[model samples]
Target: MHIKEGGITSPRIEPRFEQLESSLKPQIAPADASWKRATLTRQPRFNNVVARNWRGELPLWVSYWVIGFIGNLLIGIIPVAVDGTLSGHGYDPRILLITLAGGWLAIAAVSVWQGVGVWRSADARIIARKDLGRAAPWAILAKLAVFVGLVRLIALAVNIGAPQMTELSRMAFFDDPDISPYALRIMRNGTELEISGGFKFGLNEDLVRLLRAAPKVRIVHLDSTGGRIGEAVTVYNTIQERKLITYVSHQCMSACTVAFVGGQQRWLYSRAQLGFHAPTFPGISAGELADATEEQREIFSAVGIDRSFVDKALSTPNNSIWLPPEDELLRSRVITNVSDGSNFAASGFGANLPRDTLAAQLKKSLAALSDLERVAPDEFNSLVDDFLEGYQKGQTEAHLLAQGRQRFLRIISTNLPLADDPTLIDFGKLMIDQYTFLNQRDPSLCYQYAAKGELDPFLLSPTLREREAALDQRVLQTAAKRPTIPAQILQSLWGKVISAVTLRVGRDNAHMILGTKVSPAQYGSYCEATIAFYQEIIRLREPEAAELMRQVLAPK
Candidate 1:
């Protein structure tokens, strides 16, 4: 409808229509240009499945950023907090199982919804980039998140579905016991309460009840390898409140020390041990572990342990143990005194325990040394006192054994001024052999003999008597067979047997009767001579006849 020319056509047109066309043309051109610009700037419609349900751009964006990220994080944190609270207080197993089930279910539902929303939102962004040819930096990151989310979902499902697999994973990571085999005992006829083994859950409650029952228990003996810190802390509070003295018999390790240091007067047996190391828990963050370690530091510090020593103890790795010597323990004030293990019943080889516990075994091994007290009372007492110190300094039983042997040798040497090392060694060996034989035969015999200060060989089953009885029985049996040797030669061989056997027996008996009065050097010489004499007899006689005599007269 353009007015062609300012000639005949323009003169005939209506003035109003011409005026309207001119005015509308200017507005139309601007509106078309503005529409094109807006189209290019606008975001594309979401292309994934969630777009069908969501129906608008705002819903998709809100679900992706708000519900997917923030909401999921909140959900994840709730369960962890709940679990920590429940576990820390030693809640029932069933309650924990129920919490895990509900928490996982809520997490799973929300996570699936979030994944779908995120998928549609990311698709829209990718589409917008393709249509407009503009950069979409979030597209790559969203794609990576989608893949990772799927992997995490699969892992979560599998882990939650299989309890054994979850437990295995936990064990591999934490390396801790699920349940401790802890024990509690009323020892010393109700005067002592012994807490042994691990410091398991509910052990503190056990302590409270036991203390209530045994009002006479003024001492708490700790012998443990460690367990739950929560249990240990509770037990510590109980001990402190009761004003009970704490003692370690065999070992007080890790969490056990927490309770041990709570004593009104902390003490450890001379040979007892206190082991330390950092605490461990599975699935805890570095920050949480640091906090837990700080708690342990505070616990020891509260009890007046040296700060440097506490640092050393807590810095030790969970897999390893740091056992400080008794002097260090005393210097750090970790113990009030080092005991000789006399006050506690665990020092004795009491009922309902294995023979391998070092304290009990040490007591048993040292019991035989009482025999030496009869001959050298001053030396014996000094020797035992030194051994107690050595034991406190962390010496092994074998080390103590060697130390005792050397001390015994010195004592014998001092008594026999002319005796040499070889002679003293022979005397030592004889004493050891006889004591071992007698102890093995009947432990009561030596114990009673030593207790009564009776050195009468006639009352005891001497080694010589057993050997002679064996020889006589063996000889009588051989004589009954009427061997086909000439009577004169047989009689001669029998006499030699008598002489050799008597020489060995007499030498052994004399040493026992007059220890340090007779020369120890003579016993070994006589034994060697007896063996040589038999060899000579064997060489001169017929092989078969010589074998019979050899069997009867061989040195035991």
Candidate 2:
């Protein structure tokens, strides 16, 4: 408690009061010697203590960098964890935003705490005071750099791993049901089977199982908006292998058209729509996309569709659907028939009659007519003469048959009158045979009938008609002695003649004709002959025949 000043001694005093008085006393030193004097007098050990303390704590820039990096890392990881927890469970997007914001605010609070620590640190305060504002700005910049670098690292990691993680999360949290999109139902009293809806992965297996269970199915009706191409190809192969007829009464798009093109006999309703497009897969690699495209092209080519059609389908972008016009459908031979739904309910094989019994009756009637043609040639000739005379006056084979049918029915009613009598069948066969013979004897008769717009070509079953058409084309191409009429013109005339007959007799009546189903080949033979004869008359420059041919050949 003694005081000494300027090399002189002071008197001693009470220790506690003297200590307080000494603590309040002030001392001054030269500016050059201030640091040394303070270091020596104000406890020189304090500098070492402060240095040791600051050594345990980090430098301000280092501390800020570490804090910012950790804060940003927490900000990144928290959101990712929250996202994984709630992913694929249909959580609102705002939940993720809120979680990220909360984490960022926490990081910012930590940064502010770190800044306060730097402001309070004895060494940092002294250094900051000496360096003016440079120290704080440099520390802030270092922290900002560390924060940005950590955030970018998190973003890179997330970008690289998000897809796989998302897929795994979805599988774990939102597994889908294993239900098929397609449904198969037997229709038209089990003669036809209707397949509806999208073509899912396992639809082909379902379709094949249904088909195996229903062996009687001859027609497959399609109603779909398309789906997996692999399943569609399987269905197409099954349908083609079975030789089943395919009918589209509604929308058939994308892969659905693949199955449609595989039909043994394809048919379309007037209002039905069929669309096509190239295959596509999102998020697939370039090589994988190329492979898929090639596979699709192969499938289309294997179906034997026109190359142009295949090209159009392939060239169309995957996002868009190409619905070709009806004329293109017909020209491409994509459909063998176009229906208006009128015959759909009743046009299946033998839908309107007992098939086996009708076949037997028709065979018997055909035999009886042949016997009559041989045994009573004179009576047959007289009946034919009367038919021809009636036909010439009425200008229609149906009219001629109607006039002769009553007389023939009256003649047979007395001899073989029974509830199941074959009289009508026999009479119809006789009328058809008479017409066939007359057409053969006079090549001009077809022209005359065609001129009057009354050419009545016989109807044939789809199978028989397609076969005959193929044979006709082959014969035309390879025949050593070609007909005077070109093959194209002959085909054109044949199509017109058949169309006219179809319009005249009505589709239902034409389908109901026993000859059409029972003896389709024979019916087709007569039609081909009639077409040839009509073409010959047209070549000979008959004005009425030429005019009628022009009208028939014009685009419908």
Candidate 3:
């Protein structure tokens, strides 16, 4: 090496990679306070490079949606690929190998390019959004997460630690030679989560395990006849913290429904039964019972879930435990989607519709009435108030039909959020519009929304272009991992009363029901009955009916 300063010039030779590392041998900082020191720090993957790189370039909302797409493609690859293979529709091994390798190379390329820019910049040090002291830290952490996500995904594929395919059937006992709480695969949709064990579990059990594991996992695979309350509490805490999807593709039972409450997104299935019964127990001292209730209350409070839901879950056991009907679960945040025999499972939590249909119909119906101006909002209100005035009332049909246009006016004014936009009187309308032409044309959304309609590919597509973001330089320097895909498909068709979105419908008012999964005409009729019933319940302030109604609302 030679130096060239100002006027002096000399010959020079570049140092090789080995020479540089060997000579610099820059020692990492010594252990700080308590333990051994390290050259680099560790962090949650989300807070790493990608998140640190958040900027003014993209809107926050856009970033949220885009991140999900990117995460699905990059992070969800292993499961998607595995699912495809098992489903008998995946690419051949050679091509698949290339596909994964290419993904790595692509991510590397992005990191390299972004790293160069960062290296050349004035504020080069990165850090994650949550732990930002410098840009350098953000870059390092984000890159690491992407890298970790990829590597973890690949390793999962390599570990097919399940029993032989010939080992079990639907009625087979739990006898798989291999077993693991970690799911072998969770599909692109929410239908199934295949653990390393050949013996299948229900939605609640898997969810509880995933939640307890915390930051290590983002999603859960739940399969259960629906087990204990304590486990449900654990699962609920996890879902609420991570804002994950809660599922019930196979069978979601009693205590399982407790954890289901924590889910921000809830999903269910066709032939997918959700059952609940009162909490079963042997005799206990009064003091023990009080202590148990307090314990239960604490669990719910910690998870930010409603204890009233616990009351409802416990209400189902009159003669014996019962699964609350899907309709009943609608009252709480627990379930997002419900379907009949529909095999779509990769959907996180609920197989929510892009839009609501009944709401739209109600809006349109109201509009037609508004045009006629047959009666004003006040007259309709008077009629509704009178109907609700009953501990029991007259034949609603003649009174309702006679009310005519006023009936719609009352429903729209009271139940809908459409302040100025009469056209938007029903939120369900928006959800319904989301249905693709295929879903709309499907004859079964009425038989049950849960059992029919196709899911959009965007929701299920596995593509990881976002992992190659400029800040993921660490990913450029490292490896990849894969995950197990759930056996359930990402696309779904729901049966009547199974489409949970109906619960959020305008239904002429706020109290949603489980009945929208029925046919459209029936949906309207059911909504009428539900609203009427609730109207009375709300108006009369009936505390007496609360306990009984809770049981009736329980899943059967």
User: Which candidate leads in TM-score?
Assistant: 1
TM-score per candidate = 0.52, 0.34, 0.26
Model 3, CA-based lDDT: 0.37
lDDT string for model 1 (1-556, tens) is: 0111111000111111011122345545655777888986775566664444243243434555555555456555756665675666452333444555556565656565566555666667666565655655565465456567767666645634345235434433443366446677776567877777777665787788988898999988787878877678889989988889998877888889999999989988877899999987543446557877998899899989999999999999999999999999999999998776444554322223442344334435544344445555677667767665554443433455567656754454334322222332333334344444445555444433322323334333556445433332233222222324566766777667556555656645423322333233443433343333444444443543344443432332
Best by lDDT: 1
In terms of lDDT, the poorest run of 10 residues in model 3 is 1-10
lDDT of 2 by residue, 167-259 (tens): 333333443122235677665556677777777655677788888888988888888877766567778889999999998866789888888
Task: Estimate the TM-score for candidate 1.
Answer: 0.52
Query: Number of clashes in every candidate structure?
Result: 0, 0, 102
Span of ten consecutive residues with least summed lDDT in model 1: 1-10
User: Model 1, residue 312: displacement in angstroms?
Assistant: 0.5
Point out where model 3 deviates above 4 Å.
1-185, 189-218, 280-283, 297-310, 339-556
Sorted by TM-score (best first), the order is 1, 2, 3
Error of 3 at 135 (Å): 93
Task: Give the Å shift of residue 314 in candidate 3.
Answer: 2.0
